[model samples]
Target: MTPLNRKKERLDGLAASTAAPAAGQAGGVDVMDPVDPVGEAGAVRDAEGVSLLASAWRRLRRNPMFIIGAVLVALFILVAVFAPLLAPHAPDDRPLIGQISASTNPIPKAQDGFPLGGDEKGRDLLSRLIYGSRQTLIVGVLATLGGLAGGVTLGTLAGAFGGWVDSVVMRVVDVLLSLPSILLAITIASLASQPSQWTVIVAIAIVQVPVFARLLRGSMLAQRSSDHVLAARSLGVKRSAIVFRHMLPNSLGPVFVQSTLALSVSIIEAAALSFLGLGNPDDSKAEWGQMLGAAQNLFDLYPHIAFWPAACIVVVSLGFTLMGESMREALDPKSRR
Candidate 1:
């Protein structure tokens, strides 16, 4: 063959040989063919979500404290909801005209139709406790919610838009933190023109806000630099939308933990305020703390009067605290191990 023709023929043959292998490879179902990396990654993410949920459930179920806490909280809620029906007598109704202090009168038992005994006035302790649950739960839950809302908003804004804003916000938080929370709450409560139930709630919420703000800010700061946040930002998402939709949702694990713990704190604070005469000033009100306060004068005489209310406070607060700890453990990625 001529030199040019031979060269062309050889080039064609090489091309053909390369094309044949490609076609053969395409026809052959190679079991070892490379997987789609994106699909595999998505599958891994779905699996991770399922596994995380399962782990959380397993951990919650296995935690005896969490179970106990849940049970206590549930019982309290039920009592509160059914207080009117379940309570044997009006919470504030003074049944006995004279002092019923250890008169050997047949005290009512729960099985005997009144399990919790009676106060000095012969008012039903069980009834008071049941009614008191409503106040405690209301104040605790509402105050925590207020704190959560205020803190998360401020903290997320500060962390997401760090600079002068962060400095200003954190400084405000620091200033609030400088004061003793109880003192501050008491002062605020005392200063209100007409303090009511909501005033106590507001006071507790204010005291709790700084704590929640600091915690949420820390979480937001950590999440702000995550890959998903960066990716969302790169997609031209609005700062507000990104902060609320992406950053906040991902950081809720920590916030939820803080919220649970904060509820317990708020409840205790409310009780303290009530015990100190700053909460629900109406004497006829049947709050647990108010009952305890009333019983303080008679503590030397009727210890049972204070015992039940104090026990309720301790049990409720402890339940929330324990639940918070368990939730924290369940939510913590590192703790999953």
Candidate 2:
């Protein structure tokens, strides 16, 4: 045989030998070769990613602080939503011809249907607190959402379209930043005169917009230069589409964190404005701030008058703050490390 034929015969023999079944087996399958080293490594990496996410979820579930915060927030929301049904008495009902701050007052009893005791006006303190939850939650949630919307829009525009647009937008932000937030809110509230709930919402939104805008701008600036953004650009994607669809989704982590923190601050601001006699001027019976304002008078005579309302405000704000911190840690890739 020629040298080439001899080489081919040897290769065929080697393949047949490799495919042969073990001795004593009539017809057994051939043993498969081990997977490629690179492919095996990739499979291990994919498995590790899934395991990491599961471990993170398990750790979060085991965290006592996060659990307590979540429970408190849930309870507060339930009470707020069901206040009218759960309250033992009408929030605005008062005793006949008696001041709420009277020291030697009749002790309220279930027989009298005043289970949680009465305020200086003889209105049920527990009832008012329950009702006040509705106002606090409404103002807090709405104002925070408004700020997030306005801030994210302006920040995304400024960051995506640098140069004169960015300069002008950032300059406007700086001007707002120079003003004291509370003072600016007070001025806006006063100018509106006997501000309604919507008016208070607008004022709080204005104060918060600058914060969101600044944070989003920073995030956008960083993301705009990333490899994926450049890759999208190279694929002939429109600037607006790339920014909104690709970059914005990646930038939402910081925006979510800021929104959570800002919600707590907005609630506090709503309370302050109401306490100063600026919010919901028409609806005296519909606000926690207004209740706090009323309670200031009976502070010395009936401290409980102010105590319950003030405590509610503090607890609600703290709940948001704690939730914000926990969410920030969870959503941030750096924090996971």
Which candidate comes out best when scored by lDDT?
Answer: 1
For residues 281-332, write the lDDT of model 1, one tens digit per residue.
Answer: 8755688878888888768856777889999999999989889999989978
What is residue 51's positional error in candidate 1, in angstroms? 4.8
Residue 274, candidate 2: Cα error in Å is 0.3
Flag regions of model 1 displaced more than 4 Å: 1-51, 98-115
| Residue 218 error, candidate 2, Å | 1.1
**Clash number for candidate 2:** 3
lDDT of each: 0.83, 0.79
Question: How much is the lDDT of residue 172 in candidate 1?
Answer: 97
User: RMSD to native for every prediction?
Assistant: 9.7, 8.6
* RMSD of model 2 against the true structure: 8.6
For each candidate in turn, the TM-score is 0.80, 0.79
Model 2, stretches more than 4 Å misplaced?
Answer: 1-48, 51-59, 95-112
